[model samples]
Target: MQEKALSPTVSTEIITLTINGTSKQLEVEVWTSLLDLLREPLDLTGTKKGCDHGQCGACTILLDGKRINSCLTLAVMHDGSELTTIEGLAQDGELHPVQQAFIDHDAFQCGYCTPGQICSTIGLINEGKAKTLDDIRDLMSGNICRCGAYTNIVKVVQEALERNHKA
Candidate 1:
């Protein structure tokens, strides 16, 4: 006789993480990815899942203060860690300097890549690796804006970088 399934089996893991300064405990499958966990149960959709292969920076998010491809990591792997998506950049009803700079500079066209651009810009600043315009451009090369807004995007990033330095 063919072996029958013993029982309807399901495994879930409870992960505790701080998202946008809010602590969340979610029961997720071991295979659930960080991007899916954020966009699905957490309802944080700002982090887009473009080219899910990590070629595009559309799925970028801050993991423990560093930019990482959320799609490449499992949610269960980040238990007890801090995460910052595009939604987390704002504070007290005010836009983050990077976000405001984007708006002021009109750095987006279709806007599908704006969130990633903004998030990456913030992370770029935190990394402290880009000291010149060319450096910034090189560091932000991973993020692709199909709308061809690179010039404006670079301006916005530069403005935000200077603004952050003044603060």
Candidate 2:
């Protein structure tokens, strides 16, 4: 008797998204989160997976130049939207000013949350909402640092703002 072979399941819908200045078209499950799409499907691992929920803000990314929690959003929801991950901020192998400032200030402990922090900072900076430490804190309230490096994170944002203003 001949044995029957099982066929693999295939998805029909294709999602087109622009990530880190590049366009990607992929077939994915409808329930796939942006975090999984970025890290696993696209191989952009800089966006860390922390809480896997929106609470931690570890998977923050810029969607149409605005910061959003990728873990809470479906990949298909961002179709046709431009995304900027941690990988997108650098140019010519040089770190973005915000990224460098974080390093200079030692803004991270375990470094697991740095990507979200930096991305959220970039969004806050672009929004012109972090003019004061209090303002920065309020704006960045979404991103949590489990290592308790809030002071250093705030310092990095302030330094980056000053540097960016001067340049």
Candidate 3:
């Protein structure tokens, strides 16, 4: 006689996050990536999942006012965190300054990486380390634009930085 085998159970936990200014309490599997958590259950698709290995920077998002590659992190690791995707950057029907600057400067092509670029740029400016054009370049190197829009992207960052300094 043969015995029946038991199936493995999936681990799940409840987490609370303030996403795009809205508080969300979600139950997710423990092994789910932050990128999947945003794109799947939450339906916030603006944060793209490119490469899914943290190399392409397409899954970048602001976590606690700092930018991080969402694909590199697990959702369970960030409970009670404030998170922002591209969807969170606008307010009262007005685009964020960085979003407007990107439009004014024509900083994107194909736009797959635009969300991450914008989020990362905002994070860079907040850090206050980009004093020169070269510094912006170095600081933003993590974001890769396959369409080769670096020149205009840098222009947008420079202008946004200038505006931030003036404000």
Q: Which candidate is the best by lDDT?
A: 3
TM-score-wise, the better of 1 and 3 is 3
| Cα RMSD (angstroms) for every candidate in the order listed | 2.6, 2.9, 2.4
lDDT digits (tens) for residues 50-143 of candidate 3 = 9999898889899999999999999999999999999999999999999999899899989999999999999999899999999999999989
Residue 67 displacement in candidate 3 (angstroms): 0.3
Q: lDDT (0-100) at residue 37 of candidate 2?
A: 87
Q: What ordering of candidates by lDDT runs from best to worst?
A: 3, 1, 2
In model 1, the Cα lDDT at residue 55 comes to 83
In candidate 3, how many Å is residue 43 off?
0.7
Among all windows of ten consecutive residues in candidate 2, which has the lowest summed lDDT?
3-12
By TM-score, how accurate is candidate 3? Answer: 0.96
lDDT computed for candidate 2: 0.89
Query: What lDDT would candidate 3 get against the real structure?
Result: 0.94
What clash count goes with each model? 0, 0, 0
- Candidate 2 matches the true fold with a TM-score of 0.90
Clashing pairs in 1: none
Give the poorly placed runs of model 3, Cα more than 4 Å off.
1-6
Local accuracy of candidate 2 as per-residue lDDT tens digits, 1-167: 75556855544468788888888888878888889988996899999898897888899999999999999988877668899999999999999988888988889999999999999999988887678889888999999999999999999888877877887
Every model's TM-score: 0.93, 0.90, 0.96
